[model samples]
Target chain A: MKLRLRGVRKSFGSKVVLDGIDLDVGEGAVVCLIGSSGSGKSTLLRCINLLEPLDDGVIELDGLDIAEPGLPPDPIRRRIGMVFQSFNLFPHLSVLDNVALAPRKVLGVPTAVARVEALELLARFGLADKAGDFPDRCSGGQQQRVAIARALAMQPELLLLDEITSALDPELVGEVLDVVRDLRQSGMTMILATHEMAFAREISDRVCFLDAGRILESGPPQQLFGAPQHDRTKAFLLRVIDAGRLER
Target chain B: MQQEPTRRQRWERRQRRRSIAVAALSSTTALVAVVLAVPRLPGYRKVRAAFFDGEIFVDTFGPLARAFLYDLQIFAWCAPAILMSGMAIALARTARSPALFPLRVAATVYTDGVRGVPVVLWIYLIGFGVPGLLQSRTWSNPVLWGSTALIVAYSAYVAEVFRAGIESVHESQRAAARSLGLSNTQTLRHVVLPQAVRRVIPPLMNDLVSLQKDVALVSFLGPVEALRRAQSFKSSLANFTPYVGAALLFLCVSVPLTRLTDHLLQRERRRMSATAIR
Candidate 1:
């Protein structure tokens, strides 16, 4: 579960989103990426999951380079699950089918077994009764939870969450975050892009401050938030402080 | 016990009653005028005798009904082929592979080339030409050839409908599925196509409605469907009662189908709005 990105670079036509990024995510550790908007936090997670093609880099999951050309992304992707900010649950599928589809279709698990596993997962996520409902029938928080359950259904080694709670209402954010906390307690490896400063400081093992597609600083949460070495980190933390997000 | 209404309520009720009375009186007056005026009009009796002859209609009904079965048969046989071929053409047009470039071009050429020419012309050319080429072969029926022409021509239009449905799925749907280890094909099958087809059902049903009626054009190749039966009676009886009967039969099918399509469209709209409420 050791995820390494060495000299990872990504761009969109003229804009460079991830500029020579380098990082390491240890097994069973939670790495929180904190930054302002357009800071490449989401893009980095996408690159790591092989959802976006990297211009240059070596992304190694347990020392196997996954970013190499001709290395099929699907096999690598099955081991690494990603939950998007938008929830991206298939609108046509029922909540249970959304969770069970990948396991049944890609993993070659039988439908009955997959449905049983899916129901168990839904019950664990407190959406057991809503298994038959479509994604649109659920609240944003519930849908986000289902999206996480869908990614987790594959039993992936590494989970990448891109601003998973930013779309939820203030009151709804806590329920989704609670699932993330439970995942952390269970020692599932994760890297998440988040604007929830308090949540990040509470749950993260290491915090990486990405500014303009580069990690300005990486350290323990207390050091990065309480006593930041980089000036940009201080300025960003000051904004968070003004916004009343950071706790003493 | 009945209570006396308030003055304003009484006035409103009176106005409503008066309006309903006026509407009924006017409609009855118009009907009387039309009935009185028709017999006085020149050539009315002869026209009615020719077009609405009961005996001719009774004579034509059985054959026309049997002939319509051919139309239904063609639709049943060709509709599935049309759907499959149309979907395949749509997928080919949308495919991004360099290896499929030739196929994409060919599909593009077909939809564009076939759509511009009139469908009847396709029926004429393929029906007569193919058999002429294959004179030695046993398969030389113009009706079969016409059915083939209908499938080829209509499939282009249907493919465009299918393409629109496929593209209507949001880009995020693809991203989410692919990120979950599903390949592009799996993503399309499991995620995109299902939603797309759901959204496009109303329009696709509309196309099928048109397709059902277009089955008549096969009569040009002398398949003896309802329309051709009408034409045959036109020549045989020297009257138009059979044509009117045929027209009524088509109305029997298309009107119900049109109403069903309308109901489906409304249901789709309601479902969309309900989902949007969340």
Candidate 2:
């Protein structure tokens, strides 16, 4: 396993967001978390990234306790990249600069070398023509692709994608998901929090249903989507189907 | 193939021309009324002789103009100092490290304390009070002390502006940078400050415009700058025209800066509206 989370808990004053969460992501596996808005999927991803302090429990990356007291998150963060739902590419930077920033600044790579690698990554994502364009000039799908390319530039052991396509238009959704599918084919370890039940069913190696800050049911995508054992999981899938989000 | 103008388009063009003609006519009439009526007032001649004497203006203009360069010099030096200190204070205020808590508190106190005091009083206290207490002739130079006071006083206001700019950056940008493994300082330097500083250019220019005029406040400490020169001319020649000359000099500098700030503000607004569409 590349990542192990056991009994992870997080709370904001009186409100608990992630309650005693436990999960494991093996090397080159894709785990998709599907649930309603307040189900703690995004929060769990953030906790894994060490962006939010875990109120309780252990997060072990390669058997090293990452959530221990005062371990500087910067180095750990470099090893695990995250792409937010909003596609938070730095607005002031050009598409090329956005992808090149971390390699040049954090990794201490020379600017010329970083630019070459960034261009290669951008070209891989079919964004070669957008190297000089600002984030505001790019379409939503293009921006999300650049965001994924930016995260990939770090060469992380694991990537956390929090609702990456949720903010995209329905017509633009496939392009962004195509990039994810390609990443999966390249054997990148990824954890995705998504509202797209159909895409989760299609692309995920494992699908976990989250409800009220806990994973209620988790299994292979076929079993979890086809024969969910829990009533809440079944109800959630029914609602998704009713909303025309998931195909029968 | 050519097309004739639409009937509504022709009517709209005529309306626009008539509106322009009305505007021109109304403004000219107002200007003519003011010009024809002002001189007939009972005290017009006395007021003009006292405040707008052509001879006094011509005589004192050179000296006052020369004195105005000192204001520009003070502005040139103080502007950079204010910007640097303002950024420092703003950074201190925004720092998230627990170790920097005291520094943040100190920055807050300094901003509040300095902003509470009037600039003129700060100048008097620093320029005269400190010099008197030190009892050193070298330290008693009001120009140096007065400029210091201006920089100190103005930095507090500028720091708030900078802090506002810094805080205006969305939290997501910082998260994105931090997730890329950049340290907090690196994220701030590389990502946050660049966007923050760009957003604040127009407001910073406004502050600089205000500072350009407030540079004259240093004359209170007896620096013999433009306002002081105008004062001397007023006392000696017993005419206020030299003061008008000094005011004209101030207007010459400030109006252009004010216009530039407005232009930048408009351009930024346009850019924001254009980009926000996506």
Candidate 3:
């Protein structure tokens, strides 16, 4: 699905989080949104997934506006999957059961079929054996992989991953990134809000830098990262490199 | 290389053990002195007459035990009624839909109004009031009316406990559940409530333990539950031994429940510490 947002705006009281935002992602494209904290990267993603109501503007899925106030989010949300920075897996559920939950409950798939699909997803994610373990028992990286599997179980047309590996130890981040890499290879449409500039540059077809609740600039990653036009983008890239989140 | 305790450390350990033993001996001696001197006080005879008689203690046991069986039956119906109604009321109170406004208002009113009154008043008002309105001789049974009163009053308190549990679940779980296309109710049933119930087990058990004791208050509405039977024994024999007998029976129920709650709390704690965010 081609996801598009136009003149989108949101605010909490006096503070505006997403100020007249506009963006577009083609089908099967990987768009990485990079910004400093509090620059509305996560908020923009949340608005697209309908987790937050839009204040003003249109969020269109394939040229059809789905952001109407009366439109129920449940059906719209089924087409959009999201992962949080903290990998909020259900603690009370077994990994397998967590993976199976959405399909069985929302989609009305029978338990046996859902579990079979969930186990396959678990096996692919190298979590087949840990399927019976609760989320707390798994490592941060493993838990994130399970989270991805859970979202994929819904077979959403678009996926939003908000700093999925940000909470993991440095050594554990690669496992989660590897799963993202595999999804990218499978032609999955994704929007990622990330601090990992190098990973963003490597995987994203287009990179968007957001600042002060607006997209500062967006273009091919190589041009944006290597020879940025915007002064703000340049300053941001310098800090990202100094922090060693980009290649020297 | 590891070193064993030095001479000073060994002496300190020995001194600590010695002090503990001495403290125990002193406290025991003091307690015994107080116990022995009690008989010399003027009130001692009355105390002995009321509580220390073996014959009255023995005489109170059988009737109180039978009445306690009646309390057990009351508990069987009341506990489940409180749990089910409490959870439903709690869910209604927490619902955000504008369409459910009236229900939300009613649930809030019910919880606040019922909880504010003493349970005893509920026994009087509901126990006597409902039957007075209906004026049905068959429905006027005190046991039935009393148990209903207890359920109504306690369910309000338990509803708040249940609501707290439901709210304690992290917002992230709801976000995740929503992203999965689960409806609000589905999210609560499948994700939030089960975890919330687990977290609330300690507090919920505390309510249950107190509720078991409250079962005795049914006697005030005029049924022959254990406390009523024990009070009758006090009137007839002029002794308080039957009260102790009733207390022992209550301990029999409350102690096992308390231990079970402790066990649940420990397991939850251990699991929580494992995943505790640094």
Q: What's the TM-score of chain A alone for every prediction?
A: 0.98, 0.99, 0.99
Candidate 2: tens digits of C-alpha lDDT, residues A1-248? 48999999999898998888889999999999999999999999999999999999999999999999799999999999999999999988889999999999999999999999999999998999999888887899999999999999999999999999989999999999999999999999999999998899899999999898898999999999999999999999999999999988
Worst 10 residues of 1 chain B by lDDT: B269-278
Predicted candidate 3 versus true structure: per-residue lDDT over B1-278, tens digit per residue: 98999999999999999999999999999999998888889899888877777888887888888899998999889999999999999999999899999999999999999988999999999888998999988888988889999999999999999999999999999999999999999999999999888877888888888989999988988888899998988898878999999998999989998998898788876764455443
Separate clash counts for every candidate: 0, 0, 0
In model 1, what are the clashing residue pairs, if there are any? none
The 10-residue segment of model 3 chain B with minimum total lDDT is: B269-278
lDDT of 1 by residue, A1-248 (tens): 79888999999999998988999999999999999999999999988887788999898999999999878889889999999999999987889999999999899999999999999999998999999888877999999999999999999999999999999999999999999999999999999999999999999999999999999899999899888998999999999889887765
As for candidate 3, its clashing pairs are: none
Top-scoring candidate (DockQ) = 2
Segments of candidate 2 deviating more than 4 angstroms:
B1-26, B264-278
Candidate 3 segments whose C-alpha is farther than 4 A from its true place: B1-42, B268-278
**What DockQ would you assign to candidate 3?**
0.63
- For B1-278, candidate 1 gives per-residue lDDT tens digits of 98899999999999999999999999999999999999999999999999999999998999999998888898888888888898899899988778999999999999999999988898889988889889956798877898898889889988888889999998989888987789989998998888877777777777787888888998887778999989988998899999899888877887898798788777755543334443
DockQ of each: 0.51, 0.64, 0.63
